[model samples]
Target: MKRHARITLLLFFGLWIGSPEGWAQTTESGFVPLLNGSSLEGWEGDPTYWRIENGTLVGEVTPTTLLKTNTFLIWQQQQPADFELKGIFRITKDGNSGINYRSERVPEVPYALKGYQADIDGQNKYTGQNYEERGRTTLAYRGQQTRIQPFTQGNVRELVKNNAWTMLTVEKSLGEAEALQSRIKTEDWNEFHLIVKGNRLQHFINGVLMSDVTDLDTVNGKKAGLLGVQVHVGPPMKVEYRNLRLKTL
Candidate 1:
């Protein structure tokens, strides 16, 4: 090839290799941002509660604006299946919210989601837990390695002995809840990480592995769905999120 032609090809691949979007789509841990930091582009939610303030995605509720149900601000760009998500969160003393992945939106309720949620709260008791928004609820608490076993009777799904759809067999493999809680920063921003690969999911906060789950429930396993942020309905609360990034595997 000619010298100029080789130079042009080199520049083209160099740009592609360094591009964030291109890298995120093809490389592990190459993050592509979900929040633009200045505006609410590529997201949908109830403007009454969700907004961007000071370059952060803020969800606030007042006593007068109490919500009847949990609401979500959903991402419109992608419905990720196997991926890693990262963000920074800050919450008030009363705040309760989470990042829901592989979740389906509720048709009856606006800005509602029902699926896997990496739970977050200011109390540190709930943060880093694996929760299903409207499904099995608490699949795994903080500091646990849980195994979900689901049994079926012929074509019908059989409930577990407790009448629950799946039997939760938990192994306290992770560190103590208090130890994981120590990594959390209340009323201040903390790093959050979530990984979902096939029927396995993991949650981490401030570099601590909070929970891990091996989902054996074939009847209710989520392969791919919407991604959303939650704002629970309760006392006056506020939660701020920033640096939303994702890397698909």
Candidate 2:
């Protein structure tokens, strides 16, 4: 009887320690979905430009016959300091689309008119790179020539894909601008990750280090307002976004 009781006590202690650690590990490592798979519960934007259809967030350009206005699908949940954002996006037409971060809120102006933009283009002319707001040109691709020459006019034409999903990422440290990473393959799914620390930024595409620019000039100080999706007005176009998630550091 004494031996059996001792064995039972030992087993109980072992299970208690082991089971709690396993449960705790799962909880800590679990990923919370930013988009709830049905509607834009935590997002705010113009209805004419952004909407959720079939679990994908769609940003559509109005018809050319309609009036033109700069509209954005802005994240209602704002992040100020360091954070990492990942998303899967696809452009249906050959046009412009971008993920805007560290942006300030202007009453009617375009969201990116204030912050740094991680630009992706479906047109085959510009490189997928970093472009500062209505300010001086920062880091850009070295070997390739942009379609819109002079680089500051903000005409991007590289890494743009039609009917394909493209992974994009941007990391911004306080008072520093992040660097541009490599171009992932289009027509299939890819992964992108970014890390931002004080005055230092790193970009990764498919587990490869693409850009590691540091000591960037301050554009909008340490903290900014919101994250936004861009739908440049011109010819009619549609862009779909999914798996959008953010982690605050």
Candidate 3:
């Protein structure tokens, strides 16, 4: 090949390697696995709802052991800021779960987190949205690029009562919600990725951008806290996670 053609080819491959899909392939280099698969060594949660099965981290809510509130399996290693988390998850059809980051434990509630979550559900309705666990609520829906603004001065109490600590503006559309949902595999294993740096958070599913949020609500936004996975309060279901890894930026 000519020298110019060779240089152009190299540039194309370089760009590809820097893309999100490319990051999926190379992120393992700097990431540390969060789970040991054989035991919950650096984790804490209710033993009744969380365990290890077939070398996978499992959280299940059985019919006889229904939960009154969502429960989480929290990683006790560290609370990472400006980091990347990636893992494989599979949930039963009736299941709902999420990966929480920059989160704090609910003081009065056991095994509860109050921060940002990369939402997941067996139905895929909210598979890639950014939802605050017990704080600002929905910051960005699937296929949305949103900016979260601080609350207005008027009726601050009412806003807080309404679970509206922040305001959100959809800056752009990433894609149609249904189109993005179509990319998710139902009741099967899927790769979930989160890139959180400063006040900007982005979620990806199977290398596809599902939601993006630039949080400007410094008053309510969190820079860092705990890392956890939850099993929501609902019917009997099972959620499994494996290959849990994190790379702090």
TM-score per candidate? 0.83, 0.63, 0.86
Best-performing candidate as measured by lDDT: 3
Per lDDT, what order, best first? 3, 1, 2
Please report, in order, the local distance difference test score of every candidate based on alpha carbons: 0.83, 0.52, 0.86
lDDT of 1 by residue, 139-233 (tens): 88888899987745443224322323356798667987777789898887788889899999999898889999989888776889999998998
**Residue 170, candidate 3: how far off, in angstroms?**
0.4
Instruction: Extract clashing residue pairs from model 3.
Output: none
Off by over 4 Å in 3: 1-27, 152-157, 160-166
Residue by residue across 19-48, what tens digits does model 3's lDDT show? 232222222468888887699999999999
- Which parts of model 2 have CA positions greater than 4 angstroms off? 1-31, 62-69, 108-113, 124-127, 142-183, 187-190, 219-222
Cα deviation in Å at residue 132, candidate 1? 0.5
Compared with the true structure, the alpha-carbon lDDT of candidate 3 equals 0.86
Q: Judged by lDDT against the true structure, how good is candidate 2?
A: 0.52
Candidate 2 C-alpha error for residue 22, in Å: 30
Q: Kindly indicate the candidate among 2 and 3 with the higher lDDT.
A: 3
lDDT of 2 by residue, 115-151 (tens): 5556655542332445544433334331221222122
Give lDDT: candidate 1, residue 236: 88
In candidate 3, how many clashes are counted?
0
